[model samples]
Target chain A: MQRYKCIVAYDGTGFAGYQVQPGKRTVQLEIEQALSKIHKGDSVRIAASGRTDAGVHARGQVVHFDSKLQIPGERFKKALNAMLPRDISILDASPVDMDFHARFTSVRKEYRYRISLSEERDPFLRDYAYHYPYPLNLEAMKEAAQYLKGTHDFTSFCSAKTEVVDKVRTVEEIIFNTSDDELVIQFIGNGFLYNMVRIMTGTLLEVGSGKKAPAEMETILAARDRIQAGKTAPGHGLYLWKVDYA
Target chain B: MQRYKCIVAYDGTGFAGYQVQPGKRTVQLEIEQALSKIHKGDSVRIAASGRTDAGVHARGQVVHFDSKLQIPGERFKKALNAMLPRDISILDASPVDMDFHARFTSVRKEYRYRISLSEERDPFLRDYAYHYPYPLNLEAMKEAAQYLKGTHDFTSFCSAKTEVVDKVRTVEEIIFNTSDDELVIQFIGNGFLYNMVRIMTGTLLEVGSGKKAPAEMETILAARDRIQAGKTAPGHGLYLWKVDYA
Candidate 1:
């Protein structure tokens, strides 16, 4: 049996998320269905680098699946892209060892959330960006992003639906960049819990809006409660940027 | 009564273009409805700088409307933005002379058409940009754009649905820029008829792909027939970048 690893990108606007659900469209289901056709007469299931929320997009989402066919990795990528919808594409595919799991083998994941901070709404970027008409304090937002870096128990930044027991995660980098009327906050972490990135964005937005201070992140982390954090930013702005395997 | 001229931007994904149509959602109707509420019993109608085709987006669309409300122009901008749907935004509103008509007083309209040349699809940009996997000859495309500049009878480029009696229009400038993995064509013209911009983009694309030569644009323009030009490019890739009145 041949094990293949593929990098996928999908626009999650019309999808119910990455995971399969009854009576709902999903990125995983569509990919598996395409794989099943290529594998022929065999069921193919893939393990994703991470499951993103509905209306959340991905740029370099990695997935791995073992197949019995001896198809070349390049050809597999082409075949999958051909079968999938225009909103999804297989960027690259490669042969991997049986032990190489897409999720387990990942050492880090990068996510970016975009906020359009302009007085006017950008009609062209409506679906891809969160429109915030109020002017944001870029300096305050940048300062807040720095405080979120390093190892911390991010219980306050996670949603209530997160099933993970451990809340401790290492945030290697948190960068805030404000360009032209848009603010992009990028987070690189070992792993993220359900809605962690979105919640963090909300927390920083509060700081930018002068409702909170940069030091509040420490107290929020100590609270170990979801209610302590601000509301999660909308799913439209969140993007799974990349997955790194070590 | 004060007449206000505003620059607007919108993502055309959910709108039925800029015109008002019964039983269909449109950008013009949405703004009109929002303004009507602020006017309090007084009907508010807006005239647009250009008529964008369905699914065509805008970054700097201009519009003008009259209102009897005592709200300042800046306050009106803020009020309209607060009440408008997430897809549309009134960038700025300034009191202009009642005679400054959006369509009639316009000097030039500028548009930018973006096509992603990367083979891998971007999930986040699916609805906002056009993706073409095939390689394009940028040099050839630029050469064709030059020939398209200046005044000409663009009957071949105009759509069949165009109702204008006069087909002659001045092409002030046509510039092609290829940066990273995207190809962007910018067009500044005195006026365009129907799908003129999309047709020009398609013809240039054909030239870039070696399907047609750059010199053929002259022959096609001289033909003065719709069939002579290339197919109309998809609406998703086109954007009304700006309109210049002065």
Candidate 2:
């Protein structure tokens, strides 16, 4: 058997999530079904770098699987894409070493959140961005993001339902970019807990809107409680941008 | 009665076209229905800068209508947007002079066509762009576009079913831009004949793909025969980008 690595992109609008549920539609389920067709009725399971919540898009999601089929990487990509639905696409596929695990070997992950600052809703971008009509204080948001750039116990920023014991994670960088009608925030981290990025985005938005002070980030992190953080941002605006393996 | 001028944007995925057609769901029909609801069952008719073909999107489409309501401009915008569907949006609305018209008074119109040059299809932009996986010669396309600019009888580039006798139109400019995976073509002109832009785009694609020579544009124009022009491109990739009047 040969291990194959693939980079995938998906709209995520109609998907339940990346993981497979009993009867729900998911990215993993769709990919597995396509692979099963290629394997001629035999089931094929794949492992992804991480799980994304329902309605969360991905531009560079990474996954891996082992297969006995001897097909060229390009042919595998073409065959999988031809069978997959329009919303899900395999951007690339390649054979990898047996030791290369998609989830365990990942060193970094990047995520982006898009917020539309236009007072009027844009018809085309309705599904891709979170529309916030109120004005934002960019300076305050930038200052708050500084506090979130380093390693910390991100328990306050993670979902309370998370079963993971180790809440400590290293955030390499947090970049905030603004355009005429939208604000984009990118988060790069060694590892992220469940709902960590969305909670952090929500907290930054509160700071940007002047509802909370920039210094409050320190207090939120120190509390180590989910109640100390702001509300979780909607899933639709989040994107699993890229995954790095080294 | 006051004349209201508004700039609109729409997804155009579910719309038949910009014009009103019986038993067909069109952009004009939706706007008129919304206006009727606002005017207490009194149907209101609007005149747009021009009609867009079926499945063609619009970002800055201009329209004008006569209304007896005494609401403020901002209120009118908010009211209309509140009633419009998710696929359509009223970006701006204001009272215009009695003599102003949406169609005849317009001096310039801009249209854009998007082509995806990526070998793999992009799921997110499926409805917004044309997937042309073939390689294109940008320089060749640019050379051909120059011959298309300026005043000319566009009869060969227009639909034969059109009833308009005056086919002479001035194309101000044709801008070709390329990104990593897509090519965008913008056409700024005083006016366009029915299906003229699509036919021109198709002809340019032919030139870019080395299927036709650039010098053939002059011969096609001199012919004044619709059959001499290249095939019309699909409508979904076309956008009524903007309508300008001074």
Candidate 3:
């Protein structure tokens, strides 16, 4: 059996989430089903870099799977894309060393959150962007985001229901970009807990809107309580932008 | 009666077309239904700048309707948006003079067609762009497009089943803009016949791909037969960008 590593991209609008559910559609389920079809009904399991919540898109999601097929390795991308739905695409696929683990071996991950600043909702972007019509104080947001960088226990920034007990993680950097009617927030970190980026975005937005002070982020972090942070941003506005391997 | 002029936008991936067919969902039908609801069961009709085929999107489609309701003009936008589906949006709405007409008074229109040159299909843009990976000769396309500008009876470039008697129209400009892996073809004309922009794009693409010579465009125009042109480009790649009135 040969181990294969593939880069996948998916529009998360039609999916329940990244992982497989009992009866719901998901990106992993679709890929595994396509692999099963190629393997002549033999079920094959694949592992991804991580799981994304519902309505979270991926631009460069990494996955690995083991398969025994007679076809050449280069033909895998085409075969899988042809069988998969249009919302999911196998961007690149190739044989990988057996030691390559898509999840455990990942060094860092980058996520992007989009907030639309248009007073009028854009029909084309409604499903993709979080529409926030109110004007935000960019300086305040920047000041608040600075408090989130570096190492800390992100208990207050993650979902209270997150089963992971060890919430300590290093946030490498937080970047902000603004265009005509959109504000993009990028979070680069060693790892993120469930809903960490969304909670951070919501907290920063609150600071920008004067609901929370920029210095309040420090207090929220020190509290180490879920209720200390602001509301969680919607999943539709978040994208798994890229993953890096060491 | 108050005449209302509104600029509308829609993602055409869901609807059958712009016009109201018997049972198929359409942009016009959705707007009319929203208006009917606002008018308390009195069916209201709307006249648009023109009709678009199935899977054709619009960003600045202009429409006018007569209403006897007592609501202020500014609230009309909010009310219609509240009732219409998420795919459609009323961008701007206002009271217009009695002499203003949506269809008859239009002086110019701008339409954009997107052609994606990426070898790997982007899952995010699959519904909005035409994935054409092959390289094209831009100079040849520009030369062919030059022949199509100004006044001409665009019989060969329109659908053969078009029932319009006068096929003459003035094509003011055909602009090409390329960035990264996408090519945007913008058509600015006084008016366009059925399938005119799509057919013209297909013919120009043929010229660009070396399938047809740049000089063949003049001959195709002289023939005045729809069969003389190349195949019609898909409707999904086309967007009605803007409309202007005198």
Candidate with top TM-score is 3
User: Could you give candidate 3's per-residue lDDT for residues B149-234 as a string of tens digits?
Assistant: 99999999999888999999999999999999999999999999999999999998999899999999999999999999998999
* Candidate 3 lDDT for residue A128: 97
Can you give the lDDT of residue A93 in candidate 2?
Answer: 96
Clashing pairs in 1: A123-B10, A123-B11
Off by over 4 Å in 2: none
lDDT value for candidate 2? 0.94
The candidates, ranked best first by TM-score, are 3, 2, 1
Per-residue lDDT for A47-159 in model 3, tens only? 99999989999999999999987555569999999899999988899998899999999999999999999988899998899999998999999999889999999999989
Q: Quote the positional error of residue B80 for candidate 1 in Å.
A: 2.6
Candidate 3 similarity to native, TM-score? 0.98
Q: Write the per-residue lDDT of candidate 1 for residues B10-122, one digit (tens) a residue.
A: 88878778898889899999999899888875689999998887788988999999887766778989899888997888888999888899999999999999898887787
Please provide, for model 1 over A107-209, each residue's C-alpha lDDT reduced to its tens digit, 9 standing for 90 to 100.
Answer: 9999999998876667656767898878678788778777789998988888888788998999999888779888888899999988999999998888889
Error of 3 at B212 (Å): 0.7
Off by over 4 Å in 1: A39-42, A135-147
Best by DockQ: 3
Pitting candidate 1 against candidate 2, the one with the higher lDDT is 2
